[model samples]
Target: MNRISIIIPMLNEADHIDNLLTHLLENSSKENIADIIIVDGGSTDGSLDIVSKYKSISFFSSPKGRAKQMNLGAKYATGNILYFLHADSFPPKNFDTLIITEVKKGHEAGCFIMKFNSNHWWLKLAGQLTRLSWQACRGGDQSQFITTSLFNNIGRFNEDFTIYEDNDLIARLYDRKQFVVIQKWLTTSARCYYTNGVWKLQYYYWRIHLKKWMGADAKELNRYYKKYVC
Candidate 1:
């Protein structure tokens, strides 16, 4: 049996963490779960208190960056596979079995197809695109699963990336042809879209992609995100 470590990087995610934990615990088998590691990026919103209430979770504080926090969680993970999940994304039932089956078949890394929790046409369209194997559709919100050996080989998430870290890692996996899109759909929060306005958030996301394509470094991407999204 392959052990699985679910690593969640959080910052002021108190509202969603408990629900996410409950869902995960209910859906996953205790025998397959190596540990649940929550690496908080200095959350002051009672996130720590909620995490403390869950005996199955192991928590740590890292600098305020998702890439940094996730890498920190990976460093302490003892599982054969490391599952990087966002607090607001919920994977399908039997996700553990699905991942282990794929690994047993020799797949090194993969992510679930995802649906944003929105009924808007564009969001639905965007969710549909994730079902395809295109690298452009990949994102951390979909939740990534990779063998620990493969993760170590890739050097883990790039700490320099304050944004686009998921794309960066996916890009590398694509280059090696080690990526797969599992058929199951993971549901992710569309709170950003609702909070930032649907079209406005979509436009900025495309702009950031274009900036990265035009050789914008991590700092440049971070600046764009802070100005537009944060």
Candidate 2:
């Protein structure tokens, strides 16, 4: 029987951790989940305390980088399927069944289409665009599900990336034509866009995509992100 190990690499996500966990339990079958792993990267906002409330969750600490954190989680996971999710993204109801169905059908890697929790027009448009099967529409906020063997074979996520780690791995999957976009919607928080201004954040995101496409290294991308992610 296939099982899923859900890995959530988070930093200072106190507001969403509890709710996300509860939602996961309410929506997924206990038998389908091998375990829920919470890899914290030095969160100071009592996220650890929130996580500790759930004795069933496998919680641990890691250095402050998502790639490093997720890779570590993958190492400890016993499940045949690895589901990497963001701190504030909530997958659709019975998401586990959906993933297992896809895997049985031979989709070794994929993510559900995503939408921001916000109702801003541009955000709405962006959500609509995600319905397409284009690689550009794919992102970490949608969450990722891959078979453990395939994930290991692909070298997992690149630890060198302080950011764009998700995109980097996703691009390779697309190249191999091994990526799928499930029709369900995964809702993600747009708090960053709210705080940073949607247009500004979106512009910088596009610029980073352009830079990455131009062959900029991870270091350059991180520097550029830090310079404007305010």
Q: Which one wins on lDDT?
A: 2
Candidate 2 least-lDDT 10 residues: 221-230
Per-candidate TM-scores read: 0.98, 0.99
Query: Candidate 1's residue-wise lDDT over 1-230, tens digit each?
Result: 69899999999999999999999999989888999999999999999999999987999989999999999999999999999999999999989999999999999899999999889999999999999998878888999999999999998999999989999998899999998889998999999999999999999999998998899999999999999899
Write model 2 residue lDDT over 41-102, tens digit each, in one string.
99999999999999999988999899999999999998999999998999999999999999
Per-candidate clashes come to 0, 0
- Error in Å for residue 127 of model 1: 0.6
Instruction: Evaluate all candidate structures by whole-model CA lDDT and list the values in order.
Output: 0.93, 0.95
How far in Å is the alpha carbon of 59 misplaced in model 2? 0.7
Error of 2 at 187 (Å): 0.6
Error at 74, model 1, angstroms: 0.5
Runs in model 2 deviating more than 4 A are: none
Model 1 is weakest, by summed lDDT over 10 consecutive residues, at: 131-140
Model 2, 157: alpha-carbon shift in Å?
0.7
